[model samples]
Target: MLETLELLKISTREQDRVEREFNMGGAQSADKGHGYHVLRVQENSPAHLAGIEPFFDYIVGINGIPLDTPESRVLQDQLLANMDKEVVLAIYSTKEQELREVPMIPNRSWTSNPGDGLIGLSIRFCTYEATNEHVWHILNVAPESPAELAGLIPYTDYIIGTPHVTLHSENDFYEFIEAYTGHPLRLYVYNSDFDACREVVITPNHAWGGEGALGCGVGYGYLHRIPKTNKYHNSQLTYQGDLKQQPQQFNDQSLPVEKSHPSMTNTDVVTVIPTTITTAPLIIETPAEPPETNRPQQSQQYPNYHQTIHFNNDKVPLDP
Candidate 1:
């Protein structure tokens, strides 16, 4: 999880700035006893600009109306009620480990229908459980593209949001681009290699002479999926494609040329097909000894002329 803390301020002086398609300073709440805990903060939204982070901040008060009632839905109700007015929030941050006041104003120009909250925040009926429901994996980024200019790394970064829009799949990202064409897209992404999340802004435009609006290819993946460390092996291992992890030593004879790349992505790496492998064993041998030969010779005589004979070999006779 990201451990950074920031305080953001957004201006709603003009009514036009207050309204957009996905216009609620991108903040939602979950039940928190008398108060409500922040669950999601849209990227570049008013909530995000005000430094409101989901799961790490709790909303204890709103517009000076202390959300201390037993009714858990009170805060969401009150915020939705004052959709077009200045709303101040009392927030507690786990990163800062303190309480602070944040100001947010709803700028929606369109009147919300009955039971409709258009401030970009989705109210959660249950406890907020962190999961990888939204993914923004950049499969390929074109040169001189907005994504490239924004420093979006391909195959390593996960896109989480576009200002107030939370992207979970490629279709969501596509729809958001089509709906908000030519809008300055502020993106919040989880970098797998860094194990950290970061924010980047890319203005979607077709004048860049690219195929797509952003000139980038993206796919869906789990947010929690991180790249594994590298390992090196002596004699048995060889350098292949990009090496993102550390190196280790091993005795394996060969690695699959296609499947043994260094980087481990969330998509295809998991479904890699195994390749054939072979092993080599060690062996030893010894030369056989020549056939034994014997030569007899008399050495000395004792008591009645005795003769001594010996065999010429490394081994001695049992009798000797």
Candidate 2:
């Protein structure tokens, strides 16, 4: 009984250590409550020098005390009281998916501007929900444009974030791209089609015979969110034919004339059905005959669809 009691105590101590390391009791989860969400970190400042990241990183605790309270003044008062003293900040990084302790001494001398905070960090007290759902959906990529050259696929790709900085708003990506004009910028792109994430390097330039720097139409919000696996189905073509049947032999004179492309043929119908439990099967019938005049291929098959340039704007609204 004594040995069992000792084992239980050891397990409890290990659990407590894990909780403190990851700030498990703090605002790690949306249900847990709120924390100081780092909005911006000024260069050469105490927070910036201490590797405090913006947007993705949150100040969850200070000096072993969890800052999970909804009151912003609690954090402000604590920081003001601890100025010039070396304090350990419990920082939760959404990008790295880890919680770490950052030690720094907050001082007003870091910046000449009195308006700037002692740590030179602008943070907001908000609930932190660890999720990768926030992303910019790629709607269209202009042909011969920087986006196209960088191999950005429309309707399948999503800009999750950048490795250097976390993107919090819709304008964040555009502003980052504009800042890196003529310079290469790395992006974390997630594709629903492949159900995978990849790093893509793209250079934004206005000389690509396009309207926008990257010449890509990006969207955000619910409608633009990455489709759930069950709701989305990649178009697959299945050839129904007898394996025993020999290849069709055609004489030079009796050869069948090609009426239109195989895609427009009624015999080869591609039915894309949604795998969602609540949704019905979506039936898409192909046209029997092709158009008389040459028309552009469908957006799903090709990325040549016309898109209105919105990258020039300072702010792009999120999709409802």
Provide the TM-score for each candidate, comma-separated: 0.34, 0.42
Task: Give me candidate 1's TM-score against the actual structure.
Answer: 0.34
Separate clash counts for every candidate: 18, 0
**Judged by TM-score, which candidate is best?**
2
Cα error, candidate 2, residue 93 (Å): 0.6
Give one digit per residue, the lDDT tens place, for model 2 in 1-320.
01121211324453354454344335442223345665445567677677665545677656545555443233455566777887666566543445555667767787776545567665545555534346678987889988899999998997755544444544444555555567776665767766555667788788999777888887766577556442101111011111011122211111011222122111111111111112111222222321123222322111222211111101112111
- TM-score between model 2 and native: 0.42
Off by over 4 Å in 1: 1-130, 166-170, 222-320
Task: Residues 173-244, candidate 1: write the lDDT tens digits.
Answer: 444454455656555576656545555767777688877777777663333233322211111111121111
The local lDDT score (0 to 100) that residue 310 gets in candidate 1 is 14
- Identify the runs in model 2 with alpha carbons over 4 angstroms from their true place: 1-33, 136-143, 146-320
What is the Cα-based lDDT of residue 275 in candidate 2?
A: 13
